[model samples]
Target: MKLTESNALARVAAYCSKAERCEYDVRKKLLGWELTEEEQQRIIERLRKEKFLDERRFVQSFVKDKIRFNKWGKAKISFELRKKKIPADIINECLGELDESELDESLRKILETKNKSIKAQNDYERKTKLIRFALSRGFSMDQVLKTLTGIIGNTDEEYF
Candidate 1:
C-alpha cells in the first residue's frame, strides 16, 4: 500500500479510535510507514488537536487493563508504560490512583492459586517457588513475602 499523508492520517485516526494509544505508539507506527519526521509530527499534532490522542487517557486505560485483566503489578505495568515512552509523572500518578488493598488482594489470589499447583519437597522449596513466581509477575518482593506468609503460615526458618 502506498503511504501518503492523507492515508496515514486516516489509518492512524482509525487506529487510535479502536484503542487507547500513546504518542510513542503512533510515532512508531508512522515511522514504520516511513513517514517523514515532519509528517509524523504534523499527524501527531492533528491527532491531539482532534482529541484522538490523549496521554492521560491512554495511561489510565493502560493501567486499568494491566491491573484488572493481566493481573500485573505496578512494577511490571510501569515498566511496560516506560517502554512505550509514557512520562514518569503520568505513570506514577496513574499507578498511585490504584487501590492498595485491591492490589494486595489480587497478589494474594495469584499466589494462592500458584501455591496449589507448585510441587515442592518441602515448605522451603514451596515458598521459594511461590516467591519467584510472584516476583516474576512484577510484584514487589515485600508484597510477595507478605502475601506468601499469610497463605503458608509463618515459619521459624526464613526462606529468602
Candidate 2:
C-alpha cells in the first residue's frame, strides 16, 4: 500500500516522537515507503523544523545507551555513530565528554565478569583470552591491558 505524503509525514513524526531518531534513520524509512526524493526532503525539513528529528540529540542518546546498557568502548560507539551518518565532529565532542575513569571502571567490570567464565591452562592463556575478548568488544589494547593488570594480578608475568 502506497502512503500519501501527509500520511507518511504523520507516521514519521509519530515514530520520531516515540524516541530520538537521526536523519539517516528517517531517510531510510521514507525511502522504504517509496517516496520521491523531493518528498523525502520536504518531510525531513518539516521534522527538523518541528524538532522531531535531531542528529545531535540522537548521537548523545546513542552514546549514553551504548555505554550504559551495552558496555561498549569508544571505538565501537564511534564506529556505530559514524555508520548512522552522524558527523565526526559531533561524535568526537560527545565521546570526549565521557569520563575516562568511568570508562575504565566499565571495562574493569566487564573483564571481571568474563574472567570468571574463562578457563585456561595458565595465566598467560587466560590473559590472552581476556585481551582478545575485550578487543573484540571494541576496547583499545592499552586500556584492556591496564585494566586486566589489576583484575588478573601477577603483572610481572609476561602476557603476549
- Which digits, one per residue and each the tens of the lDDT, describe model 2 over residues 33-90? 9999999999999999999998888988998888788989999999999898899999
| Model 1, CA-based lDDT | 0.90
Cα displacement (angstroms), candidate 2, residue 156, comes to 5.1
> Residue-pair clashes per candidate, as listed?
0, 0
- Runs of candidate 2 with Cα error greater than 4 angstroms are none
Model 2, 14: alpha-carbon shift in Å?
0.6
Q: Give the Å error, residue 139, model 1.
A: 1.1
**In angstroms, how far off is 79's CA in candidate 1?**
0.7
CA lDDT, every model vs. true structure: 0.90, 0.90
Candidate 1 lDDT tens digits, 4-109: 9999999999999999999999998998888999999999999999999999999999988887888889899999999999999999998999898988988998
Residue 105, candidate 2: C-alpha displacement in angstroms: 1.5
